[model samples]
Target chain A: MRRALKVIVLGVWLLITLFPLYWIIVTSLKPKAEIFTLPIKYWPGNVTFEHYADLFSFADFGAYLLNSLLVSLVAAAGVTVIGVLGGYTLARFSFPGRGALMLAFLVTQMLPLFIALGPLYLLMSDLDLLNRLAGLMLVYVAMLVPFSTIIMRGFYERVPVALEEAAQVDGASRIVAMVRVVIPVMLPGIAATFIFAFVQCWNELFLAITFIDSEDAKTIPVAMNSFITQYDIDWGSMAAATVVSVLPTLVLFAAIRRYIVEGLTAGAVKG
Target chain B: MRPAFTLRKARFIALCLLPGVVFVVLFTYYPMIRGMVIAFQRYNLFDITSTPFVGLENFRAVLAEDRFWTALRNTGTWVAVSLFFQFFLGFGLALLLRRHFRGRGLYQAWVFFPWAMSGFLIGLLWRWMFNGQFGVINDLLLRTGIIDQRIGFLATPGWAMTSVIVANVWYGVTFFAIMIMAALQSVPKELYEAADVDGASKLRQFWHVTLPHIRPTLALIVLLRIIWILNFPDLIYSMTGGGPAGSTDIITTFLIQQVIGGDYGRGGAVGLLILGLLLAFSVFYMNATRFEKAR
Candidate 1:
């Protein structure tokens, strides 16, 4: 009885958890009429790729995808570089205002992005960066770098100082030691930080919508919202667009999920 | 006592730190100060030439509006109900996942996928699911004989808030589950073993051994989750745009609406209110939990 109950509960939770994902994918593949049919079809009768083709062909979906890619890639890379340096310094060094710097990062993490929205818009406009991918990149980097630095700090904290000291004793320069020994050791943590930063940039919506206005510069989320706000939505194509938007993050997530979980636990549990 | 700071070390640290500091100050700190200043001015995005200082007029105007109170109440409901359900269901799910089982890794991945997606996209996905005319949810309920007629989950004011809360709960469950599960794993086995040897029941063992071990994690997660849920408006914004007469409108959405409508002064006023609320909450939470003392 106990064993059966466990199995049943787990199965129910699984169905509930996975159903939305399943439903969206199915909706994307279904014919338009079938999507709105009463007593909705649990499974698509005729699997079709018409919506996917339409998204790529008639819509500005290709530009949106490219824009998302360019913005997220540059922002994620910049955050990782900054995060690694700042994280390492905080983890391994003692300097004037180190405590203040750490507190500042924490404060930034807790701040509501809405607080910055109105002024940031004005600032971006003043700089003539409105509707530009570069402006969005700057905002994303600021939003993500603080959290990434904290995650990177956790990674560096786990590494013992002895390793770096041993390298220095062997006559290696500090920079050379970090590159040869510390970097290799911290590769998994760096990978985890990179994936986390990349996914955040890929998934951000509010700022993207606010900052990017032109059709050519819009990211997937904003473009998807445009489809939503319209009077008549092509449901199938919209669902397909949703799938395309989430696919990259989902792939990156699956590949390094274990590391991501570990990174999170390390950051929080230790505190 | 501190380690001696050498010249080369300071130089290296400065080099590493300069870029990140500059970016943060320009984008984060500068905008924060500017947002505060904008709150005191009669600023309108549509009219850039007349942003003169207006003292407390904007704050008074925002606070006087009935919509502000409605949004405040809705925000409280949204955060409280969502957090309550997310905490319990998430903890339960974590316990279930803790037991080793077949295909558990895949199950974990599937369950946590929602947390990986954008909140706005999640909102859109749930909006489609709760569609008044063609939603899968209504279809399932009808097919199962739960309701004789279709229900407008998002169109009805009473249900709109519930619908968005449901979506928020679903999106947040994985966060609590992941954190609690990690804490659960790190609980030493010896405590359970000792309890069993001492003639304690399973419930007692759990109460004594498990709860205490995860309390800190629980406290921290709860604090962070509250702040996150309060600041989050994307899911609700995309789902209903706080529609059906603003029943689902939260403070964040209200502020966003003001900004979108080109009223910068009112939006900045609400923004400052949110910041003040968050600051107060953080101070209270730190005192209640004694988190700072622990640190």
Candidate 2:
């Protein structure tokens, strides 16, 4: 009896947690007329792919997708590469201001992103970078690099220093030694950091909205904002867009959910 | 170690660190300093040529506004109420999930999915659900005879803050659950056994054994989350645009509004105010927890 109750409670909680996502999927499939009907349809009566079809024909969603892909990929990859090098340095070597550097990285994590908003806008505009993908990429790299560095450092701390020393004793240079010894061992950490950075860049809206105004440069999040205005809400198209936009993140997250959790734990509690 | 060798090692390390450091300084620190400078100027977007030092005029003006005070009060409510419910519900859910069960992995994945979702998207989802005319919430409530009329969850000042907080709590619970569950699982099973030997009840065991072990993680996460919650305006922004009557407006969204209005000076002032609050909170938190000394 007790076991049954536990299962039922957890099942109810799961339903509550997933109801919004389920609703979006259901709403996306419903015919347009059923959407705003007084009695909300629990399930779609006439299922159709018309909304998804409309998104492609009428919107520049393709461009937004490409921009999002380009920005997220570049920013994530840049952050990971920089993070790995910096993480290794912090982990392996004792240097001047090392303590301060570590503290600064932590402080960066706590600092509100908007602290740099106005100035960065001015700077980007002055350099003719406003409404540019490259501008967004630069800002994202700065925002994410600190967190990625800390995660990378946590993983590096777990690897024994002896392995790197052994590689060096075999006449390998420091950089080469890290490449041969540390990279393979830290691949999981690297992947985790990449996904974390990628998801962050993908989900970012405030910065993207602020920086990119052109149709060619808009990302998925910013592009979706057009559906929502004071007058009208294109519910069907919006739902379709949401599902499309969140699909990559959901898939990537499910694939490496454990790593994401572990990375967060390390970054949050252990760091 | 020889002096030459130590120097070379330092140089190599510095070389490795240089790119990351330069990026951070140029992008993060540089912009922050610039933002501070902009707080004292009339940096309008359209008429940048006439920009001149304004000497605390922006600060005074922003502070003098009625919306600023409303946003401040709403921010306090948003953070405090959201944190209260998230902590309890999250802790409860974590405890429930801690026990090994069938399909726990699947349950865990779905339960944690909301945290992976973007705040704006979550806001959109909730907005649809809470739509007064055709909302799932009202449909369910009406069907169940809970209410005769639909509540405008996002349309009224009284309910808008609650509505947004509900969404925030849903999105944030998974974070607390994930962290707390990890902390819980790490507590040695032997502590429970000892508590059992002491003739403690299940609740007592939780209070005396589980609570003490997880206190540090709990405290730290709460501190960090307070800062995060304050900075997080995305969900609130999308839902009501801080809505019906500026009822749901928080400082972050208020600052964003100023920028969107082409009032960079005022926006920068609000940003500085937020920065100051966060810095003060961090110092107080660290001292209260003796976080630095513990290290």
| Clash number for each model | 0, 0
lDDT of each: 0.86, 0.86
Residue-wise C-alpha lDDT for candidate 1, range B175-259, written one tens digit per residue: 8898889889989999888998999998998897898888877888888888888888989988999888999999999999988
Q: In candidate 1, how many Å is residue B230 off?
A: 0.9
lDDT of model 1, residue A262: 62
- After superposition, the stretches of candidate 1 with alpha carbons farther than 4 Å from their true spots are A262-271, B1-3, B291-295
Indicate the fraction of true inter-chain contacts that candidate 1 also forms.
Answer: 0.66
Q: For model 2, how does the per-residue alpha-carbon lDDT over A120-223 read when each residue is reduced to its tens digit?
A: 88889988999999999998898877787778888898998888888989999878999999899989779888988898899998888888888889999888
Leading candidate by DockQ? 2
Interface root mean square deviation per prediction: 3.1, 2.8
Q: TM-score (chain A) of candidate 1?
A: 0.95
Residues B186-212, candidate 2: write the lDDT tens digits.
899999999899999999999879887
